[model samples]
Target chain A: MTAQALALPRAPRVDVRSVAFWVMIAASAYGLWTLKQNSVPTMLAFPPSAALNVAVLLSCLAVGVWLARRVMRPVQAPPWNGTWLALMWGGLAACGIAILMNTRLLSVWSQSLGLEAASDWSAALTAPLNEEVAKLAGVVLLAAVSTRLVRSAADGLAYGALVGFGFQITENFTYGLNGIVMAGGVEPFTATFQTLWIRIVLTGIGSHWAMSAVAGAGIGYLVSASGRSAARRVWVAIGCLLLAMGMHFLFDSPFLGGLAGTLAKPLINFVVVMAVYFVVRRAFRARWTAVSAEEAAAGTLTEDEERSLSRRRSRRLHLRAFPAGPEREAQARVQRLQLALVEERVPALAPAEAVQPWRDAVAEARAAR
Target chain B: MDDFKGNAVHGARRVWVPLVVAGVLLALTAVEGLLAKALPASEPVPAGTVIEFGSTGQVSAQVGEGWTLDRTASDLHSGLLLTRGDVSVRLTSVEFSAGKPDNAQEMWDGMERLLGVARHSGTEVWLGEPTEFDTKWITGGLYGSLQVDTAIGTAFVLPADDDAEAVEAQVLGPFDADQADWTAATEIIDSVAFDEDDDTGETA
Candidate 1:
């Protein structure tokens, strides 16, 4: 075979998976464009407040990148997978369900505890305990279905972070729309944007993701440990879940009277989250190194296979690193779908079927660019 | 292992960057506060300059070789007018007086007696309404009635002989306690012909 034939094709086959991926990208792009159009006038008038919002957004993006790097280590299965899609969509759905459940449960709990009539602190106390547990349930479900997917605490955290990000985006849109209606003009829109930036971006403190990752890591450990029973893993998961709930509770508590009080909680939460993140990162690095050494010793993966995998991964990363213009965005949409199919490990679908939707997405993305 | 350690260091650096930026912003705010103190204080309106008026009639006259009056109306039935250096004022629902008199209380009592009579019977008198009504008539802008008791009724009217003259007349009514008050009544008149001297003096 020629070198070109031997090499894996750069283009992805179009399919249902590609269609779904393209649709999501298109929806997200449209949503962002609409948001920008709505916000530009207000932001221009209130530059300082707008600057504050942008600062917060940039900070959140930085934190997100950091979380992705720290938690998405170890090449258990490639980063692109059907499970990722499911996790993103399922986690977002779970957050909605959780919020609903938490509201109902908290209402009852508060009434029972005579906290129904209380303001601020009482509500905060109830919310962190109830909502954090509910939001972490998706992470637990993921861990249960695919223990190998979460190789370390970092992996758990990464998965949780993605889920939390999805939830936050949805919640922000809700608040933004409500603000537009309530304020009925530019002033309200600016205020709403600031509020959204602070609540979602500043105080994120890895609440949903950190808590869920703790739970995910514990479950992963239980499943992977040769000596551990399934029952032990369940208990470990439960314990981690409870710990996360406590952290969330303390983070949300209103012990402080003013801005000082508000800053204190997020600061403390950040410290705790950082500590957990570092510990998990260390464990992931060690475990991956050990696994690589053993595999080399056993010769399960030859030097050639390892080199091939490395080259493949690098090519994928290179594709992502390309400048994000119209043509590049289209290519990315196609490539991501192909990767998703490969992750699914389904050989039945024709390559053309897999590649077609991606082509369409690329075309649309190109137009947008 | 070296690469791993380098990555970890990079991660630590990321955490400190935001903190440094925050510190810089705080320092800038402090500098702004210090600069604000160098600005000058604003001046207040000078004394004797009429910045505002109170709820009582006040007539300020600038009299040199000639006389000019700046009168302000206040309250119901209270107003001030001046002509030829003579200032007349009516107090709220009660008093009336003339001249740039210093004792307002004494002047008010004398005016009150005339007004009391005007109120009891149907007498021609100029009455001030709420602030929304026109004040030009009370400010010597137009002919109006200034009535005392039934025995002494003063009517402000244009003279039949001279269209330019604004004159007041005291008419005797049948309900007078004393008929002599009518003959003794003082009528203040102003004629537009007074402007001839002002015009001739300006030309000279």
Candidate 2:
């Protein structure tokens, strides 16, 4: 069967200019307002240094977004647009809410009960529950806003990681700013720089992003699964959150260090990073399988095409088999057609007609070759 | 369908969209930076004063003379560490989560385990069983003493109050003889106070 024989059906494009999107935007604005109010005193405390630190951090965040997008492109991942949205609307909002909920409210609640605001035990006591819930809320918000975009577990995971990264960067900046003031007007830059290096560079991935991605997978399941029982979905969601909290607790607690000595922290971080990687990798593999199966069933994808879809090495090897120029171009068209075909077949992705021109181009390229 | 091909111009615009959005975010960040710069500096929290921790003024304490607030020892609700003259006294209050054992004995046992006394043999000197004692804020509470070989030396761990599931506060003293001004450390511990009206307390 030739590529021309394959039909390209159309689905209605899901627009992001809806009332719900604006409403979510408004909610984020409100959260930001609250955050500013809560942060004013600290901001004023370390003004000049805080400004410089924030500027540097903002630049770093931009670079981070650019880097993350670059990493995603190789895997034919979703657009960077949604990742930015999750960061701004989801991540920033969650950060504001977390500050209010965890820092202000939870502390009051704990102390009202005559509890020792066990500052040392914060990672286990306060952070896991408040931070996870706040961060996960952003994923939930994105899912609610763009159901079509976040149609699968992988999408949920990617968006969730973006949200977590956003929260982490903003929180890190705030922590650095606070650290400046706490350093009691000492070497502000040195204090702020040390804080940034440790929080931003050292523990960046193993912190919020890893935790939220797992929880977002659970969110992915809840939204994507049509026939699952409500009870089952609730349990899955709870289990994912508990796992996220457990990871956060481990990272925050001194328990592991006590057990493994100095090796405890890095060991825990390694275990967490590996666990999250496997979980997300498995989800992506499952989605890829589903996409391949659909394309194969439709006769749009040959066995060779499906083999390339299975692994990055296979895809690269297939491309390298062709010489440069027209031969390589033709092979590249085949790869593009495969991707377009999957998008067409995958539920709630881009419409088939949108990719029709690419299919025709591939057909022409093959004929020319 | 009119060729179903997106125009080259439209594709180019799509590419520019991310850059435009990023530019706007960067501009907003710059504005925030400007605002931060404009703000007047906050008055520094004075040393040796009764600085309130969190919204719950419930956890309030004065750092000893020449001691500053050790934020590393502080959290969302709790304050820790009053350092002066080679001695540092750490005061921490932790609320137990629901469904956890609340008895004083179990709590002390947990603390012992946390300090690695039960796990690491011969590393710590456990003085004896906890006896009933009273701090300024807490009345009729179980208290015990231990000497950790590590940086965290002599410590007194005890319950904050007599509630069935009360918060636990520990006052860690110095183990080194040179830094062993137990009188000043005890005074710092005694100065620890908790307010009943948490909602009305300062949000610092």
Candidate 3:
């Protein structure tokens, strides 16, 4: 190991599960209290049917989970536990925090500042700042559970996206319900459906997930990124957090005034998404390079193996080059071996014994071929 | 040495990434500003003739020639009610004693039912639906439309020009009214304008 690698800080072995469990319980209690205090009366009147809200939430959950899995597939990240954590603590807990901020903190701060709740400044200034911070808390909570889970910028992004997915889906459901109430207490289904289409189908990608993922990359760099100098890590962290906030600000701002209702909305969404894509792609590639370099140093990876594993599509292509019968088995062996390599590398992950069988399977497949 | 090089490159990237992101955002904002400027300030009110309303004449409607102003039924703030043949365009703002309702259309519906406006002599025929209406100078994208008594006697209720506890309405006369009168009323509503520069100078 390089002196720099040995000098890198290790996170304390905290009991992440217990901490996460307590956080969830607190979030649930707070959520129930808020619901009783604010939502119950309106819900009784049935502006939008409860069933429709549940359907939207569940459907979004299913799609979000599926998307999280797909994104991790390319990276060969172990995602089930992290994905579950994101859905429960990130989704449900983060949502509770957001509601508390919106209902209580925002209102109190606005009043103190002598700003009316409906004022333009309140939305332009207070909303984006508070909401982004609240949502970022979800990523922080995820990291707290297990720093190893987010040991690189790429891992941070995937987990962050999942956290964002949870928050977005929950917030979308509320927005759908609110739209029903706004459209004059008639045809709840129509109003809610319209809201769902706009929040979910149209602006979903440009919304919470994209912004939070950028912030998560920053958190990832701070906690992980062993090679980076401390000052560089701080700069990256600050830059990413600010970028996330700025994206939210630009989206929420009425700078274009009435003209924004036209072609400007989609244009702005495209710009923000592209900016996030740039950061994400760079960070992801950097982490991959670091991992590959480590493998190279270990002398366990052949030149052919290294080339094949470099890209997801290329890796698949390399596996597929063998004949169909044993070729498929060999492909599976390669996948298992790669997964095992990742597990073996991470100290907090499964031990070397767990990966031995997968290595054996790869050797058997190579011999058969 | 490779690790050192990789770290140096990443460090450099970290410094430059924010600049790139900021530049992109600034460029997009500039484009938005330019596009907004290029678009016309507002579409001109359609009809050649205009009737000014409100104390400061902040609100105005472009009316067709044949319609006569109903001064007794009108005021500066409520707007000038116009009548031609049996058709009447009662330009009025419905103010709510309570703060703004969660849904303005539902509130209007309740008011109509309570006032028995649609149930004259117990013969009832009224239906409402979500619809779109545009005033030339001040366009509300979508609003509520209620057809009362006849196909032609419709009341379009929308969010007020600038008030939350109030709604703006343009009611047309029964279907029996002359075709020309109906056309004129619709035209006038479509061409309603608001001039924010002339704030009604009223102190609370």
How many residue pairs clash in model 3?
1
User: Which segments of model 2 are wrong by more than 4 Å?
Assistant: A1-14, A35-48, A55-74, A115-123, A225-231, A254-270, A290-294, A310-334, A343-369, B1-204
Q: How many steric overlaps are in each model, in order?
A: 14, 4, 1
Report every candidate's CA lDDT: 0.39, 0.57, 0.55
Candidate 1 lDDT tens digits, A1-369 = 222222232332112322334433343344355445445544553445456555655565456645554444433332545245424532344444444444444434333332112223444555555455444544444433332233334555666555555555444544443343222222333545756766675665545555555655554444343234668756866776676677677666656646676667666766665666677667655544444343334443334332323234653565555676655655455344334322222111122243334334433433443
Q: Regarding DockQ, does 1 or 2 come out ahead?
A: 2
Ranking by DockQ: 2, 3, 1
TM-score computed on alpha carbons, candidate 2:
0.57
lDDT of 2 by residue, B47-83 (tens): 4556555334455655445554444334535445556
Candidate 3 lDDT over A11-38, as tens digits, reads 2222343354355456646655654444
Winning model by lDDT: 2
Q: Is candidate 1 or candidate 3 better by lDDT?
A: 3
Colliding pairs, model 3: B54-B76
Sorted by lDDT, highest first, which candidate order results? Answer: 2, 3, 1
User: Ten residues in a row with the worst lDDT in model 2 chain B?
Assistant: B2-11
Instruction: Decide which is better by lDDT, 1 or 2.
Output: 2
lDDT of 3 by residue, B65-168 (tens): 66665433444544456777777786654443224455555555534543242243343555556466556555453444555555456665555554343335
| True contact recovery of candidate 3 | 0.01
